[model samples]
Target: MSKLSTYVHVPMENRITVTLLCCASFVCIESLRKNWRPALTHLSNGLRIIESLPMSMLNKLRDTVSIYGSANNTEEELGMDYILRLFATWEVSCALFAENFKPVISVKLYRGRELDDKPLDEFESITQAHRAIVQYTRDIFALVWLFRDHQGDDQFWSQPIPRRQHEILSHRGDCMGGLFERFMAKPQAPPSGTGEHYSLQWLPPTVYPNLIASLGIEGRFKLWAEDPSAAPGRRFSASNRATTSKAAYEMRSAKYPYRSFSMKHNEETRHTYLALLASDGRLMVFENEQPENMSEYTPIDELSICTKPSRGEEVSFKVRFDPNPDPCYNAMQAGVANDSLALVVAGMAAVKIYRSRDVITTSYGVAQTQREFYLALEVGVHRGLVRDVAWAPGNIRGHDIIATACQDGFVRVFRIDTPHSSNEGKSWSTSELPRYENHQVQTCSRAGQLNDKQQHQSGLSASLAKSGSHAERHFSGQLGQVKHACKEIAKLDSHRTPVWRVGFDDDGQILASTGDDGKLVCYRQTPSGDWAKSSELAIVKTRMATP
Candidate 1:
């Protein structure tokens, strides 16, 4: 062969080898990718199947049902309750009250402990055992009973089975009978001295006949049906009204010798009736008559009452009031202001200010225009209280400042001012400054014009300056403390009980508090503006103690 021909042939062979290698690599890559998907999919499916099986099934097959019914009803009348009790009782007697109930398969116990292998023999005959079981079941399933009896043994299974068969048989009938009996009996003794007790029987629904009757008559009342398939029925009048009306009552006994009670009217009732039971058991009824003009009276949806004990079985009344138009007002802190505005913290969203005034009459002059106002604010916190409110210096600018404390331990400041800033510059206009628009200003400066020079002259200037200058100002020149919004700004930690009430002074310098533990704590603002325990005042001790 010639040298040129040999070189040319070698190049051709190299190209063919490179092409073959590429094809083999491509085939291997495709094969691997093809197998990957099925493997991943199979793994995912197996995990899902495993997760779907419940742990309960893995252990044992025990079923539990909760029954509810009237305590007042007889077995026949409480049809379902009666049947469940009967079934449980019958199962227990049949299973446990036998000559060979728990067939002995030898087991060992600790030396100090002793085992009683005595068989139950309470029933005279199988028929009697069945009857006892039925009676017992009726007592436990207090409301109603629902079950399927597959075996025809209901008629004759009461008879004791042959001893030889006991070993091979599943013995479900006997097992069920025994279980029902145990449940019907008192719960295994709870750890000694716990004093906790629970009964299988339930309270009677009939106890609230008045409530049911009210719901039936009032078309608005409806029951909360858990099952959509069940009939949509009207709940007893009381239950429906209780859910929708927003009217409620809470009664607390006044110490050992006194009693106290409070009632709240529902928002639905434009007119409300409140009955206060005093310590001596004397009832005082206050009827808030509906106004001729609905706009004049603020609709009261939620109500609460608080009472304080006085001398000799008489309680001085302190009512925590709320006029809820929305569910937000369901929880509120209430206080009376100088016999005028009834200050209330309604939910976390707003404060409700209510006032009642009498009108003079000429001859048969009928009183008119009992005004009610609701000042809503976005800054309100849930379970927050309008602990204390004060009019700004002079009340000249038609402005009022309010301080609120919340369960979360945050204190919020809200300013109620005339809607028009133009009116603010003018001297206090007594023209009954039309209801002020409640604005939740970011700072006091945004709320109104601040005298910077005067602020600088006074010690208060430092606090106002930290809020920034005019260029950053968004609203009126009012300045607000951002840190004051924290729930713990005015915390009361001295008492172990939850702080129920909180209040702040005009400068936001001092905080007053009361709580379930019946202790009053005073906290003062530190130089840094954080609240600290007041060194000047000793804690005011309350005479009463919580139970």
Candidate 2:
């Protein structure tokens, strides 16, 4: 590395040769005790030299290597490959370890100089997955930085943590029995009482259809064939399911690509509804169960459900269904009907909840009924763009829990509490609203405004009322339409970078988040009703070299 640094002022051809040798040496010394500062310093200098080379010269070199080096596998080709690989590895590592550290070598700098493509293998698949994860983190970090610049402090999180029926999180670590038991092989012993013996054998791998290739991220939805336990060999088969169903074909070939999809099943009606978030900022909902011989179907636009759109033109991030069967009844039973369900959609700096509403109308002496979704609540306490949202599965606790990842460098956990279902007869009247001293008014609501008298009657102090006269705005088109109440119980800022994703354990006991910092953080509620960090795993800032 030191030799490479000294050669930075040498002739261009000599500098390239020396830098290549330095990179090869740096990658070979793959010891944990080795200092990376010198390697990074000299590598940056080497990349600068390469970046300054003329494109025509680089192209001519590439052509020469392609024509003659294919047969000999020359040492020069191998050295160049090592240098480029080291450059990519250090570039991604520096971006993940520090905040806002720009890469020294841009994509255009090495546009046609990347390493040669190799056949798919275990190592190749792992390398691709790692690159995808890094790209996702950088995208989320950029989004968060853009929003946080214009954002101010939020008083909604400043208030004391309110008490709720679901304040305590039950521990589920013991439910897994023992950690080692899961990985150990089972004994070949028969049951004491039952006289039946079962065979345990590995099933053959089943290959699926290939996905369509595209420039941007694209996904396809397909349903696999049912298990064939009684087949000749008792193995699953995809013999007749080589092609997707008609509905799946239409969805895959749609005009807009889908970012995410979710499904909800209704026990009473025995029907399932599929929700899709399009890349173009549209929400489409369709009934998953279709006729066997149906030749035509309704377009997704006509089947699109209602949503509380965001003020900005940002694309929708994620759409999720409340895992609870009756989220509406559990959270806002007082106002919503018994059969309604909750659906969550996250977008730019906001997460909104919609509830199913059935409307019946009679026109020209005919009666018709239609199911539509209406915005029930909107949680905009996040100071940055909302990246992901997760709804915890229903548990013994009476309230519903939601976790959101935001660009504001925090993973926020909120509990949906209703005075009606959680605690009978404990309702929040319109006249007794909580006071917000530092509440921001400009982004609160763009549709409605409250006068002095209304603000005063909302139980705000004189000073608070004066500062917040225009603070009570709704994202659902009009004010006073949303009656659902929710509170942010915990804000986990251990990531200290834009969080990309958040998820809850199966039992909703443990919440985990990950982001640009390359750290996995898990939170559990403490006895004092506050969320505390339970464990953290750091995955960034490490070098992996093959011997």
Model 1, 412-495: lDDT tens per residue? 444443233333232333322212121112123321233332222232332233233323211222211011111223333554
TM-score, every prediction: 0.25, 0.49
Candidate 2 on 288-316: residue-level lDDT in tens? 33433111233222223224345544554
What's the CA error at residue 227 for candidate 1, in Å? 52
Global lDDT of each candidate: 0.31, 0.51
Using TM-score as the measure, the top candidate is 2
Report clash pairs, candidate 2: none
- Model 2 Cα RMSD, Å? 22.3
